[model samples]
Each structure stands twice: as structure tokens, then as C-alpha cells.
Target: MLQTLKLLLPALIPSWRFFDWIAPSPRIEIKVNNDWQEFRPRPDHVSFPTMMKRMVWNPYVNENLFLASCAERLVDNPADQHSYEQILNRILADINDQKVTSLQFRLAFIHREGNALKKDIRYVSKIHDVSGAQA
Candidate 1:
């Protein structure tokens, strides 16, 4: 068990950055061996090399009734050599480097209106868009 934990430490640990060289960065790089010479190249040279979307929580959208967040944007092209997983890891590393863990607290909403009335609110959680049509 100890040996397994030690081996898996790198992947599980949160990567952080430092002004000094003591703390090394988590570098992820991927190489594809698609021989261009052996195979015929596609007509569209402008094809995206990598694409990914990040879904993160939005503090601005938080309310006493609901919580909401959205995808900021879609990254169409990233490093050509990096795979999707590699790019994800790189992004995670950057986020970890910038973010600092802190304590969590609960906030209550206090409102006064309508004869000083309070109503219990219930929100419906929709998982996804289940349209009949294909994506």
C-alpha cells in the first residue's frame, strides 16, 4: 500500500508554482506518430489541433434559490503535440498554482418586503438537454 501511494503521489498531488525554482511545474506533453509522409494529408490544413471546454462554478450566479455556472469559452486550438488529457492536466496545474484552499462558510439571504413575508423556494435541477434530435 505504501509503495502504491508513493508511486501515485505525483498524479494525485496538486501542482503549484513558485517564484523560486524549488517548486517544479507539472509539465504534460503528448506526441502523435501520424506519419504525414506515409499518409495523405487532409485538404483542410486549418483544422483544430486541440479543443476543450472548462465547466467551472460561477460565484456571480449563486443565489438563495439556485446555483449556476457556465462554460467560459471553447479553446479551439492548443499545442499541436499535446493530447486532450495533457492539455487538461496543464490547465489544472495552472489553476492549482493560482488557487489557494481556504475555509468554507454558509451565507444566508435576508430580505424584507411584501408585509415582511418569507416563502420557501424549491429549485428543479435539470441534468442535461434531452432533445429528440441528435447533437
Candidate 2:
């Protein structure tokens, strides 16, 4: 998936800033593939990075979040898997019917002392702009 993304990123993204975890308020990462390329657009085969138990994501993260995140990115941006994960999760919330579930941004309250899972949510609607977060 990472290799595919690098190949397809340039066309789908009008302009993008790479994201990083260090060195700045919002870190920017460089694309692994060379600068300009076109996406092949194969939603069926795109794969996600394995979720780690000690990762920063919520406690109840599951395959739904993983797969939906991919589908969600196809609609918005098909190139960046990281961006797809973040944006796709939010949009996936909206995809569910209104009567069944409300679009509400899910939150986890981790205590400073223990970092335990205090809450679990399946929906999120308060997010106004998920512009920069690339997973």
C-alpha cells in the first residue's frame, strides 16, 4: 500500500504537506517515492499498516476503523494512506445512517497516571475540518 501510494500521490493531491511526529508543531514527512507520480486507483488491494497495541490510537481500534479509513480516503484522497486513515475515519462516521448512529467525534480520556481507556465511541460529528492530520 505504501508503495502504491507513493506511485499515485501526485495526481490525487492538488498540493500536500508531508506529516511528521517531530521537529515542528505539525511535522511534514517526505514521500518515499520520487516527487511526481499518478495513482493507479485500486481500492480493493490497498492495505493498511498493522495497528500496534502500544500505539497512540484509541483503545477500541478495530478492523472497521482500519478498512473504513481506507474506503473513506478513496472518496477524498486516494493516494496518501495516512491521510486516508484520518479523513476516512471521520467521513465513515457520516456514512452510517443517522437514525442508527449519530455523527460524533469519538474521544478517549486517558488518565495521566495510568493512560487507561475511560470511554469508547463509535461516531464523531463535531470535527469541522480534518485538514492536516494524515493518520
The CA-based lDDT of model 2 is what? Answer: 0.36
Q: Ten residues in a row with the worst lDDT in model 2?
A: 23-32
lDDT of each: 0.27, 0.36
lDDT of 2 by residue, 1-135 (tens): 998999798878756554432211111111112221111222454235534432666433444345444434443443555754564354444433323222223222222235543332222224334233222
lDDT of 1 by residue, 1-135 (tens): 998899689778856553444221111121212111111112453323421111254332232112111100112232222333333333233334333232111112223455573422221111222222122
The Cα error of candidate 1 at residue 23, in Å, is 15
Among the numbered candidates, top TM-score falls to 2
Per-prediction CA RMSD (Å)? 24.6, 17.1
TM-score, candidate number 1: 0.15
